[model samples]
Target: MEQNLSLEQIQNFKGKYPRQLWYLFFSEMWERFCFYGMRGMLVVFMVGQLGMNDRIANLQYGATQAWVYAFTFIGGLFADKILGLRKSLFWGGILMIIGSVILSIDPKNFFFIGIGFTIVGTGFFKPNISSMVGQLYQDGDPRRDAGFSFFYMGVNLGALIGGYICIAVAEGSMWQSLVPEHLRWNVGFGFAAIVMIISLLTFTQTQKKLGTIGISPLLEIESSKRKRMETLTYVGSLLIIPVIIVMVANTVYTDYFMMFIGPASILYLLYEMKNFSAAENKKLFAALIFIIFSIFFWAFFEQSGGSLSLFAVNNLNNTILGVKLSPNGVNNSANSFFVIGFAALVGLVWLWMAKRKIEPNTVIKFGLAFLFLAAGFWIFYYTKFFAGADGRTSLGLFTFGWFIITFGELCLSPIGMSAMTKLSPLKTQAVIMGMWFLASAYGQYFAGLLGANIAEASEHATNLEKLNVYADGYKQLGIYALIAGVILILISPLVKKLMQEVK
Candidate 1:
């Protein structure tokens, strides 16, 4: 399966990869700018401005994050059949822009509405864009992994810039002269909306370079039928937005929603298994196993946005060498900074190992991811020993912990994205990609459960008590991650065999 490129097309780029990759790269970068910008401040805003208890805020954050990914399955279904990737991305961007504007209005009731819109919009946009990236390369292209790595770097680049900028805006540090302190968070949300518009424009202008890759729907329909379907989609989306807003505001309902959808989704995948050839079935099963493991990895890893953000604010020292930093925002950027710094190096290492025929398989790479995640948590757990009289630990330690987890992310996230495209049957590619994110949804839900404990424990009067609670939680998480990593490594060979020659 060669790329859809003629000799002239091949010669035009004069680069190792297609020219479209750059366009996708920039498009994704701006989309991520909108996403991570708000994400960097979400929990903080909920706790500080909205005056929510930490437990409620954590639950809401977790539910919001979960729905954001969970809804991707629906988005992927629409793209795989009715909407096509291009239209999905376009509409998703429009919805997100609107959501960001709504979020800027007020953090009370409007927050849930804003989150609801963004969740659905991200569902439509995120997975389809990634699937388009996969379509740019041929099956078994060695550059495929490297291409995704480069794409992942763009994601992190957006995170790095947006994280800092949003924090500055929210804190009124950047535009203090123009914006009042009370309205700074609104300014940050507005910034996100503005960047999302840029992302939509970039994709709209440059998507033609994709050469029909994501331009048409997978299932052809009559023009009249297509219009009807599009109308239904719009109506359905509008109706569901309020439902999601309700779920996010209610933890029990959110839990029930996840419980119902999680197993139902797996059963749906199982029911579709009969559609594939034997070999494809085996590969899909392997992908499913990896996806399940990914849920575990993400459950712990995703604490960065919830408990970890709170940890930075309430527990870590924000002063570094006499410079006061915004701990939550700066800490959020740490993982992205590490990714930007090391992604290319890691890609080179993987390529070098491949040349020597010693590259680890995808399953083993996933195992390594769990191991790194375990180590990262253990590092933070150990920081309990260094807690000062103020009950705060060194900011450097938390940053270093994030640095280690970035390595774990490099091993899992982009590699998982590549694996989904490689392993799924061609007919169901986008849905499978959505399943990958669905794993993250489960992880996010689990993160909320775990973070709620931290929030509950943080209610203790003494800093020592808070540190003890966090330490206890991390100690258990580290142990569980270590065991999971080891079990995955032990079974890697079997999973690899199931892959049936997919590396």
Candidate 2:
């Protein structure tokens, strides 16, 4: 496959995809195992183990997620010009392993340190690996979207496994014989670190399957120049560690940092826009529009880890068929389980639609995503009416809500990844991918802010009061999302024009 077949021959490849897809698939699976494992437990650990209030925990979690994504810009810059994707991924995986290990120690001061390292590590790893996936196919490859969906399935597969294992272990629902209850969170973190080591090993052993793809910097540089760039990256990374630690510890700093960085990043992207041709510029403008819309989508969608998790704990009856389950565990694993079960079907549907040239364009797909998101939230919001005397909704409702959200994710997330590669100039692929995730950074920060508000509003309130607060919030968000989806649909024709038929 690496021999660069013509489009016809490439389209005729086995399994309708390249062999390297599996290597990347498994590598990303394990990496996500490490990432989601820790993430599933973070807010819960803060609330339970560290005795933090929900407001504080939500803010910190938001800051951590925001910074983790924000650093992708720096990592993408390094990979595009200096380290290349392979080296960036390797170093990123190493740092993540280290961070997970630090979290396993469960020391107080080291909490932020661990989060800091993991954030920077993820910044380096996540965007580069995804960019590598895009590198596998030529421009206009018909198989690109399906391949990404299959790859996305791998991501959810890992998330499913990691979410269940990490949450079960943290809750002492599993491994009680070997892991003490008080130390279970540490064990969960350690398990994540072990999986990261496996991810690094898998990628290292199988990267040869990728041939020359992601093997070198996009632009050639002298050895001395490369060395200096690497040195600067190292120094800058080290310098930022303490700053991230400080920012995470202080909400004021975190807010100010995001406010400044958000505009600054957009300005830089605009400056880079001058380098593209007119057609490329139009596509980028469209990309930016989609990016902005995605921020809103993710802000609500990401509640799975924050408000939704809390809702499960506080207001959901977590019994399924008379068996008890961990609320957060179920919540964390729900969307992933649905994605794992349905992503192939979704992919096949896309392929079938594409055969007739009827597949939705990127913008329309994004609009569908918002519509689904609104529907999912509305599903949950209306459950307030079904609350029993105990003020608990059925576990089935939460599960169904996530199932719907998974459909929305299917429409937006992977398509957004593919779109970044297709829409941006080749020179700025990684940077634009980073910007795509930067939208996620903003979404995470907004989610944190929203979660904090909900926490504060519900403080010392009854279960009914909490339900009412959440219901009101979800209703407003749902209406907003529905309106956004409508707007996007109306504007999609124009956006497609700007895209210059890249799809």
Candidate 3:
């Protein structure tokens, strides 16, 4: 009886979750492993292998990550109009595997080449999977939140594993006897490719149970044109590889590219507004506010991949509570590890408050996220005080700062995803999700700039000089986050009005 169920019937299932959710969960988990693993390695490899200066490495990291995210908007649009979710995801996975393979074969030489494929690939894979998960539940289903939360845990689980191991291998902390120092990077990147293959296979094998959930929207179109459209998407994505590589290698081009895309995206969204009613438009505007704020949030938070990763390499001690560990791995994985530990407990705290009629609304929750972010960055800056004469600091305190930052993430990110879906009209869900990710693109771009400036500020070769400069930069970010949080809280009423009954 269940085998023949349509998308609607699947959504109507009488369980805490439809069985397909676990498949999607595992698929996304492996994809995230590929992604965060690459992220944790990028700047480190640039400095350690390619012989790039700190400033250049930061900018390149920013540009590479920015493009990776910016393409999600394009990927989302292509999925909505032509390929649909399933095809987009499969194609994206293939591209990512290709990218990782390229790097594994020769990471130092083909770094930008590999990253270009990854940028395009991630766009197609990231947003659509989340949308498919949403499709598994009918609107207003009480289980929807739990299902999404379950999926969120999958994301972190992959990040935790990949974050730890991939960089560990790259840094020669794992299988030190097997992986030579020079080839460690090759194996590290290879791990991403290997897991992405797993992610794709998981999706292919399990997606049967999803029924018509993610089918291409063009079945009604004539066959020839549909084939042509699919061909064009693949070719176009491939052709853009060199362009992305150029932009990433030369940071100035990234600025030009973003200047074009950022405003163009706003205009396009405004054009999209014609289809939505006034109230729906207001809710979208509110969602936009959140997206805009999120850019700032991510800019600071993403230091983990750029500046903090470098910080971990240079400044921190090599142990957490007496067990020897890789500081870079800790830097990369600590937040993800904390998210795994605390995500459910934090959700329960919010639920408990809601049941008592005292829960913070989404807007306030967003504000609290910034406040927590501010506190976390402040703690990061305070690490300078804990540093030894050699400028090395306590790994335990550094990881503790991530604990507070995790709270901020718990407050905003999941809630923001929920709000984006709830507030947008049915027709625009994928586009809005794309926009949410695009905002992350902007954040990543700026984070690179921020990290570069900090890197540039320290001319001396001393570890102490680098520590003070980076710590001071973090202090400034903390102050900015503090102001943003306070302002968001102050203006909550207006955003609440825009949200209407969304909470």
lDDT by candidate, in order shown: 0.86, 0.85, 0.89
Residues 1-503 of candidate 1 have per-residue lDDT tens digits of 13455434533444446778889889999999999998888888889888988888888889889999998988988888788889988989999999999988885568888988999999999999999888877777777787788899999999898987897679765667888988898889988999999999999998766766776573466888888897888789879998888888787898898989878878888888888889999999999998999999989988888888887777888776778777887777889999999987888788888889899999889989989998999888987888888879887887788899899999999999999999998668899999999999999999988998887977855877787688778878989999998999999889999998899
- Residue-by-residue lDDT tens digits, candidate 2, 231-331: 78767876788888888778788788888877887898889988778888999998899899999998898777888778877888878778888778899
List RMSD in Å for every model shown.
Answer: 2.4, 2.1, 1.5
- lDDT per residue for candidate 3 within 1-503, as digits (tens), equals 55567988888777566888899999999999999999999999999888988988999999999999999989988998899899999999999999999999999789889999999999999889988887887765545555666678789999999998999999998889998887899999999999999999999987778898878889999999999999999999999999889888888999999999878887888999998899989999999999999999999999999999999999999987799999999999999898888876776676667668787888899999999999999999999998987989999999999999998988888778777778787667778888889999999999999999998997565998789999999999999999999999999999999999777
lDDT of model 1 at residue 317? 81
Q: Is candidate 1 or candidate 3 better by TM-score?
A: 3
What's the residue-level lDDT of 339 in candidate 3?
86
**What's the lDDT of the predicted structure labeled candidate 1?**
0.86
lDDT of 3 at 265: 84
- Top-lDDT candidate index: 3
Error of 3 at 292 (Å): 0.4
Off by over 4 Å in 2: 1-15, 107-109
Best by TM-score: 3
Give the residue spans of candidate 3 off by over 4 A: 1-3
